[model samples]
Target: MKNLNCKNCGGPMLIDPSGTTANCPFCGSKYVLDHRDTDYYRDFYERMRGFLHLSADGQERRRRADELWDSAASEVFECSDGRQIDIRSMHTYKNRIMTAYTARQNIIFRFDIGNEDKADRYRKNVSSIDYPSADTRSLSDFFPRISGGFELADATTLLVVKKREDEYPLRLFGTLSGRHTAWLIGRMENLCCVLEYNSIVHPEFGLDTLYIDPYDHQASLYGGWWSAVPNNTAVNGRICTTRDNLTALRETAAKVLGFESASAARETEDVPKPFADFLRSTPLSNAYEDFAYWDDVLIKSYGERRFINMETDDKQIYGKGQ
Candidate 1:
């Protein structure tokens, strides 16, 4: 038996090795075990936290995140702006390495560094879809939306830059004492929200090549483009990616890519409508609800893409004339 806390009540509970259900003693709530994976537990706990309106715990989460940033900044690389660029993030993925470094100041400087091999792979995969002419020009030509020109330094590292405002086409967000970092983070989260949406709508998307260019608040996911800039919420303000525009974009892309959905997936299951719903119902204080809501969106977006892809492949095999 393993001791764990109840997701709903946060009270103590014990799990039997032979049993599948976890019953909460205090709340009398029962949750079925799902694979018992670490990620499943994380999600389970997060969902419970959200259900309990546990934003108060966010302060601790924020503190831990601050510590991570501080640790990342412990060893600094000086930048042109007299501020330091630290390794804000870096990790290895199979044969590839992905890293993000930042200098938070009046003008933020963020550099996304990856392995040349990985960059080349991405370049090859996305170029044809992005470039109608099949032009294999420079990296900038390949991902034109990325203002930060590619820096192919040595045989190892490939760097792409993006910022709030690109003085040099690719830079970092910096305005009034790191205010843009929040926006940059928000931009990244928004892209994840979209990717989560895509993962549900198309399971194969896998978010493997999900790229968010904060410079323009846009994203590229498995060759599809997405607008991820957050909408203002003034009393009479409007939301980004209105239902009409999203439907148009989806239909246009589907037609261009020859995605003939015999039975089109429900539009409400995607991010646009549900996100809009979140914006309407969720108060400013419960901003954390947005992440939980988007997670649900991502889960729902899966499998739908797999079916569409299969149908598209069938069309390719049978013949476009048919």
Candidate 2:
């Protein structure tokens, strides 16, 4: 049985292999562990991390990204303060890459879409969605694609840099800190926390530490974009499980994108309204109390997503729509 960490307290998870839920050590909250959520992000993370490991394709992709940036750089003109505007995001699909540009503290923005991956999901998500901040383009289209920590385990390195006379955008700059995202859905348990990374070889304050507050959109339960996260989680939060642990993502690109600059600025958290009605769907033991055939009703892991696919074998695949 694979182990899952607490997304709330960032401690070892107490999970029953046969059970669908797990509890947080620091905060005392329960979460449903759905397989789909776990596997999808895991695939996504692995795929992206693979891109970092490829000795042959890495240079080619970076070179191509640079060439594309060169063609678009000419379009940028000086801002009133002479601040430069250049590609901020280089989102690559099978063959094509879409580069987004923003300048002067994000006051101006544009995008450069190139390549030929007709099956490209990046093009679909980013091209049409309405961006949140006025000047910057919205990149939410990849919301379902790059959604969590499973991708982090595969990331043995990171790439960060300046716009080079158009050096390949975002090449060799900083170390990345990522993690598993799904099973770690937030709960009010343990109230324990730590910083975590399976490969931290040095004496760090222990693995990972975190606090749990279900109401915070930035809570481990939801996804946070700026924090280099595909799911909603805050630093110093728990680390049991996440979508990243289970995905098989391929051909990926990301960096410390930016903060408080997109519509997806934070998680949308609130005590679920119709709180009582919503509770009816939760697979809590007492929730099955109202019905006589209670034992037959299984409490799902995570939330509504798994609840729907529970009875039958799962048929969904990542990168196929999500």
> Scored by CA lDDT, what does every candidate get?
0.31, 0.25
Which lDDT value does model 1 have at 79?
A: 45
- Give lDDT: candidate 2, residue 137: 31
What TM-score does model 2 achieve against the real structure? 0.18
lDDT of 2 by residue, 64-99 (tens): 445433433223333334453333333221101222
Which candidate leads the pack in TM-score?
1
Residue-level error in angstroms, candidate 2, position 120 = 34
C-alpha TM-score for every candidate: 0.25, 0.18
lDDT of 1 at 205: 26
lDDT of 2 at 250: 7
Query: Against the hidden true structure, what lDDT does model 2 obtain?
Result: 0.25
**Runs off by more than 4 Å, candidate 2:** 1-53, 56-58, 67-322
